[model samples]
Target: MNDSQALGRISAVVSENDVVLFMKGTPQFPQCGFSAAIAKTLSQLGVPFTPVNVLDDHAVRQGIKDYSSWPTIPQLYVQGEFVGGCDIVHEMHQSGELAQLLRDKGLL
Candidate 1:
């Protein structure tokens, strides 16, 4: 797919899923450390999320970066909102903020 198509696809995925993770690989087999960290955090929180494997699609990999303007993978979206990447996720997880957010969203 092209840029516009990729963007459209991403928007649909985020809107359709209550929780979304645009990462390098599936939750079962993350391709990178950062992706793994975020996936683990979400799993540990018992957050039911849709994992978008960017590695499977070139357009999606670049599309997600452009879509979020975050220049990173493992981007988290909760209730269609942009949550940050690995370090931010890790910090939040450690501080219990991640769990709190999930609970607030009825995802935990």
Candidate 2:
């Protein structure tokens, strides 16, 4: 499929699921440090999410960037909204906002 098509598929995955994390690797084997950090944060918050491994598909890897308008993997989407990456998630976690947000979305 094309880039937009690939991105549309990923976006549908995110939208259909309550908590979706498009990361560089799986939850058990995060490829990047940031990906691992985000995984840990999500775990710590007890937010159950489906992880999409970008490494599994090149189109997904590049398309996700275009999908979010953010040039990064390990992107977090809550209720279909692009929530940002590790740094932003970390900041939200530290400030006790992440949990609240998840709860608000009924994902926590």
Q: Which prediction has the highest lDDT against the true structure?
A: 1
What is the per-residue lDDT of model 2 for residues 1-108, given as tens digits with 9 covering 90 to 100?
Answer: 778789788978987998889998898999999999999999988888889999999999999888888988789999888898999999999998999998887777
The TM-score obtained by model 1 is 0.96
For 3-100, candidate 1 gives per-residue lDDT tens digits of 99999999999999999999988889889999999998888777888999998889999999999999988899999999899989899899999889
Query: Where does candidate 1 stray beyond 4 Å?
Result: none
**True-vs-predicted CA distance for residue 17, candidate 1, Å:** 0.5
Q: Estimate each model's TM-score.
A: 0.96, 0.94
In model 1, which residue pairs have backbone atoms overlapping below 3 Å? none
Candidate 2 stretches with Cα past 4 Å from truth are: none
Residue pairs with clashing backbones, model 2: none
RMSD to true structure for each model, in Å: 0.8, 1.0
